[model samples]
Target: MTRAILEPVDADIDPRVLRDIYGQFPSGVAAVCALVDGSPVGMAVSSFTSVSVQPPLVSVCIANTSTTWPVLRAGRRLGVSVLGEAHEEACRRLAARTDDRFRGLDLHVSGNGAVLVDGAPAWLDCSVEAEYPAGDHTVVLLRIAGFRIDPRARPLIFHRSGFRQLVER
Candidate 1:
């Protein structure tokens, strides 16, 4: 089998034209996870953000064609693991469709059994509040149930299809 990168569509053809363009700005990686039956289902993403403060809401988008997103979205509860400098391997593993993405990854469950990935800069255990279709992706809005921030760990970043670190000014 063979594959080739598709040619770019017109400026207004796809709303997600900005998606590939947005890679110019370095973005942090995170794992959006939920428990399916007794096992963990997760997807690595760079498109997550806190959307609200008073209500403590966060959001992430998953491609409509993603097989993992459907399974992970089945539950009412989830955990968002914000990757740290040490979690590059974990990020790569989860982003692929290979066996045992959790292999060799240190993890533990929160009081609610939400998976808190070790060595992350932050973790958010949440209840999925809403989900809506947006172009070719599904935008998930969640209400935070619990959270942890690790000041000792620096957030990992991605830019222009590559993992990167910011230089101090």
Candidate 2:
């Protein structure tokens, strides 16, 4: 077995280089959304992850400067939809800085007011469990209330700052 050597990092790290380095790891994209003030508020996140199974916890990182996170956190429940491979356009639309983020997409709203995107591979209905500061972004911990998965769909992958589809070998 070969062991890799480790090196110490410098204090000054270029944000662009850091982003590029992080982008090397492919991750699934998810639409984090909620109904706020009688409307749907959402944002696309590549940082969604499952944290715990005992309490059904999941998390998504939101930028500290995000205007949408404020509105989303005010809602009782938040929705997380794992985008499908065919949802590249929808993901772009959801991430755009526009008034109507949910403008031309099929949606499903839960009784607690989580707005879920249609055709997503999976959906998670959650409530904010906790939040912690993490550099320029806020790590939001969500406690899952309910969830569903579609067997026929595949997740949308974000790699090197672009959308990618997985090929079955």
Candidate 3:
């Protein structure tokens, strides 16, 4: 048996190199949305993760330059939709820097203004609990008020800078 030695790169790595390295890890896509002034405002994020179960907290990283975040953060409640395998187009649409992000997408707006994708595998009604400034991004902590899960739906996976599907062994 043999093992190859690996070298550590400099701390100030190029952003493209960093992205390429980070893309090696697969992640689930989430659509964070809310109803603002009778319209759906949303963005697709691959950095969504569950933080604390006891306190019912989740976190999503938003780029500091994101214009949508400022608008969405002002909402009373936000909906985090764990997108399904069938939502590739919807995810692309939401991620685009366009005005009509919700166009042609099926959605449900809760009484509290959380706008969720209709067939998402999971949905969480959350409010912004806290936000921390990170380099070029903001880590938003959300307090989960309510949630629902559809066991049968398969989640949309992001890997190697593209959308992917799960394969069972």
Which digits, one per residue and each the tens of the lDDT, describe model 3 over residues 1-169? Answer: 8998976789787889889989999999999999888888999999999999999999999999999999999888999999999999999999999988888999998889999998999999999999999999999999999999999999999999999999999
Query: How many residue pairs of model 3 clash at the backbone?
Result: 0
Q: All candidates' TM-scores?
A: 0.87, 0.95, 0.95
> lDDT rank, highest first?
3, 2, 1
Q: Count of backbone clashes for each model? A: 0, 0, 0
Regions more than 4 Å wrong, model 1: 1-20
After superposition, the stretches of candidate 3 with alpha carbons farther than 4 Å from their true spots are: 1-4
In candidate 2, which residue pairs get closer than 3 Å at backbone N, Cα or C atoms, i.e. clash? Answer: none
On lDDT, the leading prediction is 3
lDDT of each: 0.85, 0.93, 0.96
Q: For candidate 2, write residues 1-169 as lDDT tens digits.
A: 9998965568787888889989999999999998888988999999999999999999999999998888889988999999999899989988999987788899999999999999999999999999999999999999999998998999999999999999999
| lDDT of model 3, residue 35 | 87
Clashing pairs in 1: none
Candidate 3: lDDT over CA atoms?
Answer: 0.96
Tens digits of per-residue lDDT for model 1, 50-152:
8999899999988999999777777657889999888888999999998698998888677676777898989999988989999878898989999989888
